[model samples]
Target chain A: MNAVRRRALLAVPVAAAVARDVAAQPAVEEDFAAAERAILAGRTPVAGGIAIDMPQLSENGNSVDLAIKVESAMTATDHVTAIHILAEKNPVPRVARFALSPRAGRAEVATRIRLATTQTILVLAETSTGQVHRASRDVIVILGACVDGG
Target chain B: MIGRPAAALLACAALGTLAAASEIRPSRDFLSPELRAQQDDPSRHPGWLWVEEGEALWRRGEASCQSCHGDIAGMAGVAARYPAVAADGVLLNLEGRIERCRTQHQAQRAFGYESEPLLSLTAAVALRSRGMPVSVAVDGPAAPFVEAGRRFYETRQGQLNLACTQCHDENAGRRLRGDVISNGLGTGYPAYRLEWNALGSLHRRLRACSLGVRATQFDFGSPEYLALELYLASRANGLPIEAPGLRR
Candidate 1:
């Protein structure tokens, strides 16, 4: 019994160390890749004309404010069609989708969302000309939200 | 909308002779410039989401709050006087009142404290009173609760052996570690806290403070929190309500 207890105590730290290592490893990037594929289809997105505003470090992940803007004249010929926000690791990566028309005057929208943990958020804007613009930001959340909301 | 000059005059008139004697500054004054700007701009403030959700819940729930209240316009300045002594003599804050109304009048299930729906409803109700003054009554039945809260604020507790007064009253405007401590006011609650990265209630912050002092933290809607809220409201008397306020 004494030997087993000693072994168990020694194994606990090792198990914890291994668990920490696994947690430290970056999550598979495939989740975002799949999400992007679904949104963009076969279109290759360029990383310009889209701006995302979010905090670099969030003390709480329950309601992080997100703002997205796309560079456009917002005229009949040139206007943003839609803006899609995605969280790389949330239970559902799709946070929100905003559709806009030229009447909106500016291609911008802001709202709050929940983040499950530290993850990259992608904001993609689709313009009338079939041009897809994308922006990504990494946010570190100290306490994740929506985990216990039943 | 009431113009600035007229509003100021009305405030003065309402405050009466002793208005100038109180140290009354909105919590916006205590925040950093960037945070203050965020609070001022509705587009940038995240608390609006809760308000929006709250507005929806008010109209659509099982027993909609709007059914009896009709348009919510008359609710203005109602939140500023909350944590008040109810007709039954029990001290109740906005959340408590919401629960009571749900159970008693609405004949519906009460939203648990700290739940999203509850927070949203509380924020919505409190938002109606935005820009009003903190004016909770500390007289009559509320007097005992106020005394209890005052004692809690002044008494030292926990491993740190520090009272709420030590930091909020005596060391206010001073730096502790990296953050500046302001006079612990309950105004601007149901506010978005950058540190919380979410909208939180006065009780949530009180629990945080209790934990900070290594003291016993109470449940969300506990009597301890109610008493503390009343005391904080008294401390913040005269400060304009900035519910759905942005805080860092």
Candidate 2:
């Protein structure tokens, strides 16, 4: 595309914004409990403390950035102890397991991950009390859009 | 002449191994002929936005790519021999290297592999290397890296159960859905994407495939990605590097 034509297409940021947002919608996970069960394997499910930040949609499945931040005081009584990341639909339910301490300062660790397909990404946070929190995101990968090349 | 039979056998084995290693593959079938042909025409109608972004950033570095090259047109053939071991001795592909430059030079956080900035910047750099033959040296430490990369390309991943070579190598130019599968080559990245209406990196392209096969993705700077890049550079050893090229 020439400079002039591209300028014309991008002139409308609203449409561009809509398209961008629409393309990034997250995937849906059909089964979370089963996935959680596999990852936890003999562990117990807890309540109200984990939040997963997933985009509404992902145009690409490879290297989608994932981050988890749990609300914690960082004191012995309420610090986040560990974080577990899971991909509900992937052959391997476990994505990554993170160990944490009050010294971590915050209940946060960020990394990019490959999404096998459009699926639910779940994050489980275990607080110092063993209290658990969970959050989920739906990600999607547009088929045939993988190798756009020149 | 009566030779040492056992020694001759070992020598024969070594020679066979070298022959196999040096054997070159034909290029992967590019996308549909229509798409493959349009990849280089800047004035080609109905362009890819990712390619556009790449072009924009190349001439005027996007915030992520700002001034990394210092002097453009002067640093020729730089992208062709990438996935090189950095000063820290860590290997990085063009995309990973771009992110390094993005963070260190622009003081901006790096984009995820799927992010537009990641793709566009890569495309921009690829465009710079347009027409330069891929000439990565696999001697010394680089050889091991390429070997690791080759394994990754052939390995199966995720529930979908697929290896990259399944479609790219065995079924090049085959049709899947409405698109034709190209040989999974990375020759013209920082490519313009018609679907995305933008320019993107080969890394972004790789990530997109991983997603399609339902495999978990690695980070942009992860060793795995670098390994894959090493393989890609090795695979396209003779193809011209055409970064920031257009695609669909």
Candidate 3:
């Protein structure tokens, strides 16, 4: 074969493989961005004064315990109004949203969530002053055995 | 310093005692520290969701579990003595007994095994017995059933041609893929399994194991599984029930 023709033939398979990998990339990023935009409503959240406490390594992706806290006095004038949880790579990035007020006594919430895979979990706490504080933690999820049984 | 033959004899003696000891450990002992912590924390444990559902079911109607049993706290230690022969002479596990109550006493249709409502009620009841040691009877009318169960445990089955004892008894604590092998104890039932993302009965877990070995998956509440449950409970005698347990 001619030199240019041989190189073109070899490049075809490599280009196809690369295309397949690109297609395999998580397509939910756009959905995640849209969901975040809906929650933030054009406000830019600063990353501080909020914390997410969760295991660094999760044994399974089915149920993961998560806890979130924000620094606030929880007063009527300066309280956390709502907390939004999002998993960047989940089919639906929005995991949960909790509405709170000064009556809640503390700016904290805890719950369990299902992780689709190893991904970053984002937490957003909106204060009464309309300021949004953000925090995120990456978790490594291990697939469980005997998953085919059911 | 010992001679070769004497050292070999000593090693055999040590193994013999280890087998005879048959030290029973709770399945939680085999969990990662994070999972173990999750199992212990009521707020964090996913099983509590089922427990809450169970409590709601307990008081749903006039012919409710609450009306008959009064306070749920009164059920403490009840699950520890289950898998017993009922007055009708049939062996029944906790789930089986719950099924009978739904049909016979309440005049309600069977919730069917492994249904969310049934699992919820069973988990609620089993929760009352948490921390209490298992004490199922293996003698009297239970003898034959226990014998059958023991036979099943010892005999090889399925395409894998492996018995329960082969992995659970001989190779427990060893790695099976990414997971650690557990002693196959049934103290935890109607427990929360992350793989299921819901609470499941011991029978469901057993059916999964059967499928894993390419064996015949038995029906829920089948006599064979009931007998095996009895045997497993007896094997776990004196081990605290960790029902609504957290498992991956």
Candidate 4:
């Protein structure tokens, strides 16, 4: 074979591997931006008194446990009413929404969620009052979400 | 160089160490303080979500488990003796037993492994045995099965060629990447793994390990997985059952 042809042939496998890697990481920016825009609308979320508990690194993204706790008195007033979990990179940014009441005793919610890729998880909480609080966690997912468990 | 009493004490200490070596502790011992606390709290435990669903399914189904086994309390301490030898000489874990009951007795479709319903039912059944000591039979007819399980544990597979013990036994309590590797135990199965974000069976966790090492994963409910489950249960023989465990 000609030298140039041989060189091109050798690069074929390398090119294919690079292509696969790029394909694995889909364009998450647009999804993230769209999700953020829809959720925020115009209200600026203040970051305070809300704790997001989750692993910094997730070995698998199919299921990742998350805990959200908002500081509240749990009285008739000054209580968290709803919490929204959004995964910036997931096909559907809105993962779960939990409604709470004073009867819940504590403004704490814990559950598992799916993450699509290595990205930030945004948690927004609304209190009985007009206050809005937000928190986000960056997770590195080794196995992206929505994989065939088989 | 030691005196007689000192030498005798030293001998006792050596014996204690040997005894401790044979004793197995629960996975709870290795959990981080925060995760351990979460597992202890019922309301906070994510696994309970499945357990609740399982309870509902048990009471509501046409062929309800309650019909055959009334007052779920009868199930107490049952999970502690799992991966037992069935009548046909097959070893069956708690999940396997649930599958059998569903197909044979209930005449209902068995829930898929790692599926929400299966996990919930398994968790509920296992919760009946919470705090009970693991005591699977490894003698008489059960001997060969336990031996098979031990052999699998020792055998290395996958491209990494790493045995279960290489990380879980030899390097337990140490970090493998960002997570701590606990001693391989089957006590807290139907566990809610933070990485899974859902309740999962011991088999799913084992399969994850197989994949992590680039080894071939055994199909769910496969004999190979059953053997490994038995081996792990045997290793955790004295540990308390902690089903519906929370793990990160």
> By lDDT, who's the top model here?
3
lDDT of 2 by residue, B1-248 (tens): 11123223433556853353344342324543433444555655223455466556655646524354554554467778786777777787776777777678777777767576666656555656778777676645676887798799889886778888787666666676435676566776656555454555566667667666767767656788778877777666656775555455
Interface RMSD of each: 10.4, 11.1, 9.4, 9.0
Under the 3 Å rule for N, CA and C atoms, how many clashes does model 2 have?
A: 42
TM-score of 2: 0.51
After TM-score superposition, what is the CA distance of residue B34 in candidate 1 from its true location, in Å? 2.0
The residue pairs found clashing in candidate 1 are none
- Candidate 4, residue B242: lDDT: 90
User: Which candidate would rank higher by lDDT, 2 or 3?
Assistant: 3
lDDT of 4 by residue, B1-248 (tens): 11223323433656863364364557999876767887999977878998899888778777788988996778897888888888898888888888899999988788877778788888998999898877776565666776788788888988879898787777877775446677879788989876455788888878877766667889988888898887677667667899989876
Docking class of 3: acceptable
Chain A TM-score, structure 1: 0.74
Q: Model 4: clashing residue pairs?
A: A63-B196, A63-B197
In model 1, state the lDDT of residue B66.
90
DockQ of each: 0.09, 0.06, 0.25, 0.13
What tens digits encode model 3's per-residue C-alpha lDDT throughout B77-173? 8888888898779998888888898889999998999999999999999999999877777666777888899788888998879899898888889
Worst 10 residues of 1 chain A by lDDT: A1-10
Span of ten consecutive residues with least summed lDDT in model 1 chain B:
B1-10
lDDT of 4 at B59: 82
Off by over 4 Å in 2: A1-150, B1-29, B45-70, B102-121
Model 4 score (lDDT): 0.74
Q: DockQ for model 3?
A: 0.25
Per-residue accuracy of model 1 over B158-196 as CA lDDT, tens digit each: 887989888876677777633567778888888887655
